[model samples]
Target: MLLVCVFGGLGTMVRYIFDVSIRRWWHHAFPLATLLVNVIASFCAGMAAAGYVYHTVDQATSLMFVAGFLGGMSTFSAAVSEMVSLARNRRWWLAFSYALMSMVVPLVCAAAGWGLVAVTR
Candidate 1:
Protein backbone atom coordinates (compact mmCIF):
# COMPACT_ATOMS: atom_id res chain seq x y z
CA MET A 1 0.00 0.00 0.00
CA LEU A 2 2.81 2.37 0.80
CA LEU A 3 4.55 1.56 -2.42
CA VAL A 4 1.40 2.09 -4.40
CA CYS A 5 0.83 5.46 -2.81
CA VAL A 6 4.38 6.51 -3.42
CA PHE A 7 4.32 5.38 -7.01
CA GLY A 8 0.98 7.01 -7.59
CA GLY A 9 2.28 10.31 -6.30
CA LEU A 10 5.29 10.00 -8.55
CA GLY A 11 3.07 9.23 -11.49
CA THR A 12 0.84 12.20 -10.81
CA MET A 13 3.80 14.54 -10.60
CA VAL A 14 5.22 13.15 -13.81
CA ARG A 15 1.90 13.53 -15.52
CA TYR A 16 1.67 17.16 -14.46
CA ILE A 17 5.14 17.94 -15.68
CA PHE A 18 4.65 16.13 -18.97
CA ASP A 19 1.32 17.76 -19.61
CA VAL A 20 2.73 21.20 -18.92
CA SER A 21 5.73 20.54 -21.15
CA ILE A 22 3.61 19.43 -24.07
CA ARG A 23 1.14 22.23 -23.61
CA ARG A 24 3.98 24.66 -23.94
CA TRP A 25 5.00 23.13 -27.22
CA TRP A 26 1.54 22.93 -28.73
CA HIS A 27 -1.12 25.49 -28.10
CA HIS A 28 -4.44 24.48 -29.64
CA ALA A 29 -8.09 23.75 -29.01
CA PHE A 30 -7.36 20.04 -28.87
CA PRO A 31 -6.38 18.16 -25.73
CA LEU A 32 -2.90 17.06 -26.69
CA ALA A 33 -1.68 16.70 -23.12
CA THR A 34 -4.45 14.33 -22.11
CA LEU A 35 -4.09 12.27 -25.26
CA LEU A 36 -0.33 11.97 -24.92
CA VAL A 37 -0.58 11.01 -21.27
CA ASN A 38 -3.24 8.40 -21.96
CA VAL A 39 -1.26 6.88 -24.81
CA ILE A 40 1.81 6.65 -22.63
CA ALA A 41 -0.18 5.27 -19.74
CA SER A 42 -1.84 2.65 -21.94
CA PHE A 43 1.51 1.52 -23.26
CA CYS A 44 2.93 1.33 -19.76
CA ALA A 45 -0.11 -0.55 -18.55
CA GLY A 46 0.26 -3.02 -21.39
CA MET A 47 3.89 -3.45 -20.46
CA ALA A 48 2.84 -4.10 -16.88
CA ALA A 49 0.41 -6.76 -18.06
CA ALA A 50 3.11 -8.36 -20.12
CA GLY A 51 5.42 -8.30 -17.15
CA TYR A 52 2.92 -10.36 -15.21
CA VAL A 53 2.27 -12.77 -18.09
CA TYR A 54 5.97 -13.31 -18.76
CA HIS A 55 6.92 -13.30 -15.08
CA THR A 56 9.38 -10.54 -15.64
CA VAL A 57 8.01 -8.85 -12.56
CA ASP A 58 5.97 -9.91 -9.56
CA GLN A 59 2.26 -9.28 -9.09
CA ALA A 60 2.81 -6.48 -6.59
CA THR A 61 5.05 -4.63 -9.01
CA SER A 62 2.56 -5.07 -11.82
CA LEU A 63 -0.21 -3.78 -9.64
CA MET A 64 1.86 -0.80 -8.68
CA PHE A 65 2.47 -0.01 -12.32
CA VAL A 66 -1.08 -0.48 -13.48
CA ALA A 67 -3.17 0.64 -10.57
CA GLY A 68 -0.83 3.16 -9.07
CA PHE A 69 1.30 4.62 -11.82
CA LEU A 70 -0.76 4.40 -14.97
CA GLY A 71 -3.92 5.02 -13.00
CA GLY A 72 -2.57 8.37 -11.92
CA MET A 73 -1.20 9.23 -15.32
CA SER A 74 -4.27 8.57 -17.42
CA THR A 75 -7.34 10.79 -17.21
CA PHE A 76 -10.47 9.38 -18.81
CA SER A 77 -12.58 12.16 -17.33
CA ALA A 78 -10.35 14.81 -18.84
CA ALA A 79 -10.63 13.17 -22.23
CA VAL A 80 -14.40 13.16 -22.05
CA SER A 81 -14.46 16.74 -20.85
CA GLU A 82 -12.24 17.83 -23.71
CA MET A 83 -14.46 16.09 -26.22
CA VAL A 84 -17.47 17.80 -24.69
CA SER A 85 -15.72 21.14 -24.82
CA LEU A 86 -14.86 20.66 -28.47
CA ALA A 87 -18.42 19.68 -29.27
CA ARG A 88 -19.73 22.68 -27.35
CA ASN A 89 -17.43 24.91 -29.36
CA ARG A 90 -18.91 23.47 -32.58
CA ARG A 91 -15.70 21.76 -33.59
CA TRP A 92 -17.54 18.63 -34.57
CA TRP A 93 -14.93 17.35 -37.01
CA LEU A 94 -12.07 17.97 -34.60
CA ALA A 95 -14.00 16.39 -31.76
CA PHE A 96 -14.79 13.33 -33.87
CA SER A 97 -11.21 13.01 -35.02
CA TYR A 98 -9.92 13.43 -31.49
CA ALA A 99 -12.37 10.89 -30.17
CA LEU A 100 -11.52 8.34 -32.86
CA MET A 101 -7.77 8.77 -32.66
CA SER A 102 -7.84 8.79 -28.88
CA MET A 103 -9.53 5.42 -28.91
CA VAL A 104 -7.44 3.87 -31.68
CA VAL A 105 -3.94 5.10 -30.95
CA PRO A 106 -3.85 3.97 -27.34
CA LEU A 107 -5.00 0.49 -28.34
CA VAL A 108 -2.33 0.31 -31.00
CA CYS A 109 0.34 1.49 -28.59
CA ALA A 110 -0.76 -1.01 -25.97
CA ALA A 111 -0.79 -3.82 -28.50
CA ALA A 112 2.64 -2.76 -29.58
CA GLY A 113 3.80 -2.93 -25.98
CA TRP A 114 2.42 -6.44 -25.61
CA GLY A 115 3.95 -7.48 -28.93
CA LEU A 116 7.27 -6.10 -27.83
CA VAL A 117 7.24 -8.27 -24.75
CA ALA A 118 6.22 -11.34 -26.74
CA VAL A 119 8.81 -10.75 -29.38
CA THR A 120 11.51 -10.20 -26.84
CA ARG A 121 10.57 -13.29 -24.93
Candidate 2:
Protein backbone atom coordinates (compact mmCIF):
# COMPACT_ATOMS: atom_id res chain seq x y z
CA MET A 1 0.00 0.00 0.00
CA LEU A 2 2.80 2.37 0.82
CA LEU A 3 4.56 1.41 -2.37
CA VAL A 4 1.42 2.05 -4.36
CA CYS A 5 0.98 5.44 -2.76
CA VAL A 6 4.54 6.38 -3.55
CA PHE A 7 4.23 5.20 -7.11
CA GLY A 8 0.91 6.98 -7.50
CA GLY A 9 2.41 10.22 -6.30
CA LEU A 10 5.31 9.75 -8.66
CA GLY A 11 2.90 9.09 -11.51
CA THR A 12 0.95 12.28 -10.77
CA MET A 13 4.15 14.32 -10.73
CA VAL A 14 5.25 12.79 -13.99
CA ARG A 15 1.89 13.57 -15.56
CA TYR A 16 2.05 17.19 -14.43
CA ILE A 17 5.57 17.60 -15.73
CA PHE A 18 4.72 16.01 -19.03
CA ASP A 19 1.67 18.23 -19.43
CA VAL A 20 3.61 21.39 -18.69
CA SER A 21 6.47 20.43 -20.99
CA ILE A 22 4.21 19.57 -23.88
CA ARG A 23 2.03 22.63 -23.43
CA ARG A 24 5.11 24.82 -23.68
CA TRP A 25 5.31 23.98 -27.37
CA TRP A 26 1.80 22.78 -28.18
CA HIS A 27 0.18 26.24 -28.49
CA HIS A 28 -3.18 24.80 -29.48
CA ALA A 29 -6.66 24.74 -28.02
CA PHE A 30 -6.80 20.98 -28.25
CA PRO A 31 -5.87 18.94 -25.18
CA LEU A 32 -2.93 17.23 -26.77
CA ALA A 33 -1.13 16.80 -23.51
CA THR A 34 -3.87 14.75 -21.90
CA LEU A 35 -4.27 12.63 -24.99
CA LEU A 36 -0.59 11.86 -25.21
CA VAL A 37 -0.32 11.10 -21.51
CA ASN A 38 -3.28 8.76 -21.55
CA VAL A 39 -1.92 6.98 -24.60
CA ILE A 40 1.41 6.51 -22.92
CA ALA A 41 -0.20 5.27 -19.72
CA SER A 42 -2.32 2.82 -21.68
CA PHE A 43 0.70 1.50 -23.52
CA CYS A 44 2.67 1.06 -20.34
CA ALA A 45 -0.35 -0.63 -18.78
CA GLY A 46 -0.50 -3.10 -21.65
CA MET A 47 3.18 -3.87 -21.24
CA ALA A 48 2.72 -4.39 -17.52
CA ALA A 49 -0.27 -6.65 -18.12
CA ALA A 50 1.69 -8.75 -20.55
CA GLY A 51 4.59 -8.89 -18.16
CA TYR A 52 2.33 -10.18 -15.41
CA VAL A 53 0.76 -12.80 -17.67
CA TYR A 54 4.18 -14.06 -18.69
CA HIS A 55 5.31 -14.29 -15.05
CA THR A 56 7.92 -11.59 -15.58
CA VAL A 57 6.22 -9.31 -13.07
CA ASP A 58 4.93 -10.25 -9.63
CA GLN A 59 1.34 -9.53 -8.57
CA ALA A 60 2.14 -6.72 -6.17
CA THR A 61 4.35 -4.92 -8.64
CA SER A 62 1.75 -5.34 -11.36
CA LEU A 63 -0.88 -3.93 -9.02
CA MET A 64 1.38 -1.00 -8.27
CA PHE A 65 1.90 -0.31 -11.94
CA VAL A 66 -1.69 -0.74 -13.06
CA ALA A 67 -3.66 0.53 -10.12
CA GLY A 68 -1.18 3.04 -8.84
CA PHE A 69 1.03 4.42 -11.60
CA LEU A 70 -1.20 4.04 -14.62
CA GLY A 71 -4.29 5.01 -12.68
CA GLY A 72 -2.71 8.32 -11.79
CA MET A 73 -1.18 8.80 -15.21
CA SER A 74 -4.31 8.47 -17.28
CA THR A 75 -7.00 11.16 -17.17
CA PHE A 76 -10.38 10.14 -18.55
CA SER A 77 -12.07 13.03 -16.80
CA ALA A 78 -9.78 15.55 -18.40
CA ALA A 79 -10.44 14.09 -21.81
CA VAL A 80 -14.18 14.39 -21.29
CA SER A 81 -13.77 17.91 -19.99
CA GLU A 82 -11.82 18.85 -23.07
CA MET A 83 -14.51 17.38 -25.26
CA VAL A 84 -17.16 19.32 -23.41
CA SER A 85 -15.17 22.50 -23.74
CA LEU A 86 -14.75 22.00 -27.44
CA ALA A 87 -18.41 21.33 -27.87
CA ARG A 88 -19.39 24.32 -25.76
CA ASN A 89 -17.26 26.51 -27.97
CA ARG A 90 -19.02 25.05 -31.01
CA ARG A 91 -16.03 23.22 -32.44
CA TRP A 92 -18.14 20.27 -33.29
CA TRP A 93 -15.76 18.64 -35.73
CA LEU A 94 -12.76 19.01 -33.51
CA ALA A 95 -14.69 17.76 -30.52
CA PHE A 96 -15.90 14.74 -32.42
CA SER A 97 -12.44 14.00 -33.69
CA TYR A 98 -10.98 14.35 -30.25
CA ALA A 99 -13.58 12.07 -28.76
CA LEU A 100 -13.00 9.41 -31.38
CA MET A 101 -9.24 9.60 -31.11
CA SER A 102 -9.41 9.54 -27.34
CA MET A 103 -11.23 6.24 -27.49
CA VAL A 104 -9.44 4.55 -30.39
CA VAL A 105 -5.84 5.70 -30.06
CA PRO A 106 -5.27 4.45 -26.53
CA LEU A 107 -6.73 1.07 -27.35
CA VAL A 108 -4.48 0.73 -30.35
CA CYS A 109 -1.47 1.88 -28.38
CA ALA A 110 -2.23 -0.66 -25.66
CA ALA A 111 -2.58 -3.44 -28.19
CA ALA A 112 0.65 -2.45 -29.86
CA GLY A 113 2.46 -2.37 -26.57
CA TRP A 114 1.04 -5.72 -25.56
CA GLY A 115 2.05 -7.28 -28.86
CA LEU A 116 5.54 -5.86 -28.59
CA VAL A 117 6.06 -7.33 -25.15
CA ALA A 118 4.38 -10.62 -25.98
CA VAL A 119 6.52 -11.12 -29.07
CA THR A 120 9.75 -10.59 -27.16
CA ARG A 121 9.15 -13.88 -25.39
Candidate 3:
Protein backbone atom coordinates (compact mmCIF):
# COMPACT_ATOMS: atom_id res chain seq x y z
CA MET A 1 0.00 0.00 0.00
CA LEU A 2 2.73 2.40 0.94
CA LEU A 3 4.72 1.46 -2.12
CA VAL A 4 1.76 2.07 -4.36
CA CYS A 5 1.14 5.46 -2.83
CA VAL A 6 4.74 6.49 -3.15
CA PHE A 7 5.03 5.29 -6.74
CA GLY A 8 1.70 6.87 -7.61
CA GLY A 9 2.86 10.19 -6.26
CA LEU A 10 6.07 9.90 -8.24
CA GLY A 11 4.13 9.10 -11.39
CA THR A 12 1.84 12.09 -10.90
CA MET A 13 4.79 14.34 -10.32
CA VAL A 14 6.36 13.14 -13.55
CA ARG A 15 3.11 13.87 -15.34
CA TYR A 16 2.85 17.35 -13.88
CA ILE A 17 6.40 18.05 -14.88
CA PHE A 18 5.69 17.15 -18.48
CA ASP A 19 2.39 18.98 -18.43
CA VAL A 20 3.94 22.20 -17.23
CA SER A 21 6.90 21.89 -19.56
CA ILE A 22 4.80 21.23 -22.63
CA ARG A 23 2.24 23.91 -21.82
CA ARG A 24 5.02 26.43 -21.42
CA TRP A 25 6.57 25.32 -24.67
CA TRP A 26 3.38 25.28 -26.73
CA HIS A 27 1.02 27.72 -24.98
CA HIS A 28 -2.14 25.51 -25.08
CA ALA A 29 -3.33 26.17 -28.61
CA PHE A 30 -4.99 22.82 -28.25
CA PRO A 31 -4.56 20.18 -25.55
CA LEU A 32 -1.16 19.32 -27.00
CA ALA A 33 0.40 18.97 -23.61
CA THR A 34 -2.26 16.57 -22.44
CA LEU A 35 -2.13 14.53 -25.62
CA LEU A 36 1.65 14.33 -25.64
CA VAL A 37 1.79 13.30 -22.02
CA ASN A 38 -0.87 10.66 -22.52
CA VAL A 39 0.78 9.28 -25.64
CA ILE A 40 4.19 9.06 -24.04
CA ALA A 41 2.65 7.47 -20.99
CA SER A 42 0.83 5.01 -23.20
CA PHE A 43 4.02 4.11 -25.01
CA CYS A 44 5.74 3.63 -21.71
CA ALA A 45 2.84 1.55 -20.55
CA GLY A 46 3.15 -0.57 -23.67
CA MET A 47 6.83 -1.06 -23.11
CA ALA A 48 6.17 -1.99 -19.51
CA ALA A 49 3.53 -4.50 -20.56
CA ALA A 50 5.87 -5.95 -23.12
CA GLY A 51 8.64 -6.12 -20.57
CA TYR A 52 6.38 -7.94 -18.17
CA VAL A 53 5.11 -10.47 -20.67
CA TYR A 54 8.58 -11.31 -21.83
CA HIS A 55 9.48 -12.07 -18.22
CA THR A 56 12.01 -9.30 -18.11
CA VAL A 57 10.20 -8.11 -14.98
CA ASP A 58 8.27 -10.01 -12.33
CA GLN A 59 4.62 -9.62 -11.39
CA ALA A 60 5.23 -7.10 -8.62
CA THR A 61 7.37 -4.96 -10.85
CA SER A 62 4.71 -5.21 -13.54
CA LEU A 63 2.12 -3.93 -11.11
CA MET A 64 4.38 -1.08 -10.14
CA PHE A 65 4.67 -0.04 -13.77
CA VAL A 66 1.10 -0.63 -14.88
CA ALA A 67 -0.90 0.08 -11.73
CA GLY A 68 1.37 2.70 -10.23
CA PHE A 69 3.23 4.63 -12.90
CA LEU A 70 1.05 4.28 -15.97
CA GLY A 71 -2.08 4.54 -13.89
CA GLY A 72 -0.92 7.85 -12.51
CA MET A 73 0.61 9.07 -15.73
CA SER A 74 -2.01 8.31 -18.37
CA THR A 75 -5.06 10.22 -17.25
CA PHE A 76 -8.55 9.46 -18.49
CA SER A 77 -10.05 12.41 -16.67
CA ALA A 78 -7.70 14.86 -18.32
CA ALA A 79 -8.81 13.66 -21.73
CA VAL A 80 -12.47 13.90 -20.73
CA SER A 81 -11.94 17.32 -19.22
CA GLU A 82 -10.37 18.56 -22.42
CA MET A 83 -13.22 17.16 -24.46
CA VAL A 84 -15.77 18.74 -22.17
CA SER A 85 -13.96 22.02 -22.38
CA LEU A 86 -14.05 21.82 -26.15
CA ALA A 87 -17.76 21.03 -26.16
CA ARG A 88 -18.52 23.74 -23.64
CA ASN A 89 -16.61 26.17 -25.81
CA ARG A 90 -18.70 25.06 -28.83
CA ARG A 91 -15.79 23.69 -30.82
CA TRP A 92 -17.78 20.74 -32.05
CA TRP A 93 -15.40 19.43 -34.69
CA LEU A 94 -12.37 19.72 -32.48
CA ALA A 95 -14.20 18.09 -29.61
CA PHE A 96 -15.44 15.26 -31.77
CA SER A 97 -12.00 14.65 -33.21
CA TYR A 98 -10.46 14.65 -29.79
CA ALA A 99 -13.05 12.22 -28.46
CA LEU A 100 -12.75 9.92 -31.44
CA MET A 101 -8.98 9.92 -31.54
CA SER A 102 -8.85 9.29 -27.83
CA MET A 103 -10.89 6.14 -28.26
CA VAL A 104 -9.36 4.83 -31.45
CA VAL A 105 -5.67 5.55 -31.24
CA PRO A 106 -4.88 4.09 -27.84
CA LEU A 107 -6.68 0.88 -28.58
CA VAL A 108 -4.74 0.61 -31.80
CA CYS A 109 -1.50 1.29 -30.03
CA ALA A 110 -2.20 -1.35 -27.39
CA ALA A 111 -3.12 -3.86 -30.03
CA ALA A 112 0.00 -3.08 -31.93
CA GLY A 113 2.07 -3.52 -28.83
CA TRP A 114 0.45 -6.87 -28.01
CA GLY A 115 0.83 -8.03 -31.57
CA LEU A 116 4.47 -7.17 -31.71
CA VAL A 117 5.08 -9.07 -28.51
CA ALA A 118 3.17 -12.06 -29.72
CA VAL A 119 4.98 -12.20 -33.00
CA THR A 120 8.40 -11.89 -31.43
CA ARG A 121 7.75 -14.29 -28.60
Candidate 4:
Protein backbone atom coordinates (compact mmCIF):
# COMPACT_ATOMS: atom_id res chain seq x y z
CA MET A 1 0.00 0.00 0.00
CA LEU A 2 0.86 3.66 -0.08
CA LEU A 3 1.68 3.59 3.61
CA VAL A 4 4.17 0.78 3.09
CA CYS A 5 5.82 2.68 0.26
CA VAL A 6 6.15 5.82 2.35
CA PHE A 7 7.57 3.94 5.29
CA GLY A 8 9.83 1.97 2.99
CA GLY A 9 11.25 5.22 1.70
CA LEU A 10 11.71 6.42 5.24
CA GLY A 11 13.41 3.14 6.14
CA THR A 12 15.82 3.44 3.23
CA MET A 13 16.65 6.94 4.35
CA VAL A 14 17.16 5.78 7.89
CA ARG A 15 19.42 2.96 6.73
CA TYR A 16 21.51 5.41 4.73
CA ILE A 17 21.79 7.66 7.74
CA PHE A 18 22.97 4.82 9.91
CA ASP A 19 25.31 3.53 7.26
CA VAL A 20 26.92 6.88 6.65
CA SER A 21 27.08 7.86 10.28
CA ILE A 22 28.75 4.63 11.33
CA ARG A 23 31.14 4.67 8.40
CA ARG A 24 32.16 8.17 9.35
CA TRP A 25 32.73 7.36 13.00
CA TRP A 26 34.33 3.92 12.59
CA HIS A 27 36.28 3.52 9.42
CA HIS A 28 38.21 0.47 10.41
CA ALA A 29 38.87 -2.93 8.82
CA PHE A 30 35.62 -4.50 9.99
CA PRO A 31 32.22 -3.67 8.49
CA LEU A 32 30.62 -2.13 11.57
CA ALA A 33 28.13 -0.21 9.48
CA THR A 34 26.42 -3.18 7.90
CA LEU A 35 26.57 -5.28 11.07
CA LEU A 36 25.02 -2.52 13.11
CA VAL A 37 22.25 -1.87 10.62
CA ASN A 38 21.29 -5.52 10.23
CA VAL A 39 21.28 -6.24 13.96
CA ILE A 40 19.24 -3.18 14.87
CA ALA A 41 16.81 -3.72 12.02
CA SER A 42 16.33 -7.33 13.05
CA PHE A 43 15.51 -6.24 16.56
CA CYS A 44 13.07 -3.68 15.27
CA ALA A 45 11.47 -6.27 13.06
CA GLY A 46 11.04 -8.60 16.02
CA MET A 47 9.44 -5.88 18.10
CA ALA A 48 7.14 -4.85 15.29
CA ALA A 49 6.02 -8.40 14.67
CA ALA A 50 5.29 -8.88 18.34
CA GLY A 51 3.43 -5.61 18.55
CA TYR A 52 1.25 -6.45 15.54
CA VAL A 53 0.46 -9.97 16.74
CA TYR A 54 -0.46 -8.71 20.18
CA HIS A 55 -2.77 -6.07 18.73
CA THR A 56 -0.60 -3.26 20.05
CA VAL A 57 -0.43 -1.92 16.49
CA ASP A 58 -2.97 -1.46 13.75
CA GLN A 59 -2.72 -2.86 10.24
CA ALA A 60 -1.21 0.24 8.66
CA THR A 61 1.44 0.54 11.32
CA SER A 62 2.23 -3.15 10.97
CA LEU A 63 2.60 -2.82 7.23
CA MET A 64 4.84 0.20 7.62
CA PHE A 65 7.16 -1.17 10.24
CA VAL A 66 7.21 -4.89 9.52
CA ALA A 67 6.93 -5.03 5.77
CA GLY A 68 8.54 -1.74 4.82
CA PHE A 69 10.98 -0.38 7.38
CA LEU A 70 12.52 -3.69 8.38
CA GLY A 71 12.70 -4.78 4.78
CA GLY A 72 14.58 -1.66 3.77
CA MET A 73 16.79 -1.48 6.83
CA SER A 74 18.17 -5.02 6.69
CA THR A 75 20.87 -5.29 4.02
CA PHE A 76 21.70 -8.55 2.31
CA SER A 77 24.01 -6.67 -0.01
CA ALA A 78 26.08 -5.53 2.91
CA ALA A 79 26.34 -9.09 4.11
CA VAL A 80 27.54 -10.18 0.72
CA SER A 81 30.05 -7.37 0.67
CA GLU A 82 31.37 -8.41 4.04
CA MET A 83 31.73 -11.97 2.83
CA VAL A 84 33.56 -10.79 -0.23
CA SER A 85 35.89 -8.69 1.88
CA LEU A 86 36.63 -11.67 4.06
CA ALA A 87 37.31 -13.88 1.07
CA ARG A 88 39.60 -11.29 -0.45
CA ASN A 89 41.50 -11.11 2.81
CA ARG A 90 41.67 -14.92 2.86
CA ARG A 91 39.92 -15.06 6.23
CA TRP A 92 37.75 -18.00 5.42
CA TRP A 93 36.88 -18.75 9.03
CA LEU A 94 35.83 -15.20 9.72
CA ALA A 95 33.76 -15.14 6.56
CA PHE A 96 32.05 -18.37 7.54
CA SER A 97 31.38 -17.01 11.01
CA TYR A 98 29.89 -13.87 9.57
CA ALA A 99 27.56 -15.81 7.30
CA LEU A 100 26.55 -18.25 10.04
CA MET A 101 25.98 -15.55 12.62
CA SER A 102 23.82 -13.53 10.27
CA MET A 103 21.46 -16.44 9.65
CA VAL A 104 21.34 -17.52 13.31
CA VAL A 105 20.60 -14.13 14.80
CA PRO A 106 17.68 -13.25 12.53
CA LEU A 107 16.10 -16.65 12.96
CA VAL A 108 16.42 -16.38 16.71
CA CYS A 109 14.90 -12.93 16.71
CA ALA A 110 11.93 -14.05 14.64
CA ALA A 111 11.44 -17.05 16.88
CA ALA A 112 11.58 -14.82 19.91
CA GLY A 113 8.88 -12.63 18.43
CA TRP A 114 6.64 -15.57 17.63
CA GLY A 115 7.12 -17.08 21.06
CA LEU A 116 6.43 -13.82 22.83
CA VAL A 117 3.22 -13.30 20.90
CA ALA A 118 2.07 -16.84 21.63
CA VAL A 119 2.80 -16.58 25.32
CA THR A 120 1.43 -13.10 25.88
CA ARG A 121 -1.79 -13.59 23.95
Strongest candidate by TM-score: 2
lDDT of 3: 0.79
TM-score per candidate: 0.95, 0.97, 0.86, 0.81
Superior candidate under TM-score, 2 versus 4: 2
On lDDT, who's better, 1 or 2?
A: 2
Query: Of the pair 1 and 3, which is ahead by lDDT?
Result: 1
- Residue 22 local lDDT, model 2: 100
lDDT of 1 by residue, 1-121 (tens): 8888888888899999998999998989888999999999988787778879999989998988888888888888889889999999999998999999899999999998888888888
Report the C-alpha lDDT of model 4 over 1-121, residue by residue, as the tens digit.
Answer: 8878877888889999988998888967667777777877877777777778688888788888878888888898888889888989998887887888777877777777667666777
Report the lDDT of model 3 for residue 69.
79
Given candidate 4, what's the lDDT at residue 50? Answer: 79
| Candidate lDDT values, in order | 0.89, 0.93, 0.79, 0.80
Q: Is candidate 1 or candidate 2 better by TM-score?
A: 2
Tens-digit lDDT track of model 3 for 2-110: 6767788888999999998888778643787777767777766776688787897788887877788778878889999999999999999889988887877777776
After aligning candidate 4 to the native by TM-score, how far in Å is the CA of 88 from where it should be? Answer: 2.8
Clashing residue pairs in candidate 2 are none
lDDT of 1 at 15: 92
> What residue runs in model 2 are displaced by over 4 Å at the alpha carbon?
none
Ranking by TM-score: 2, 1, 3, 4
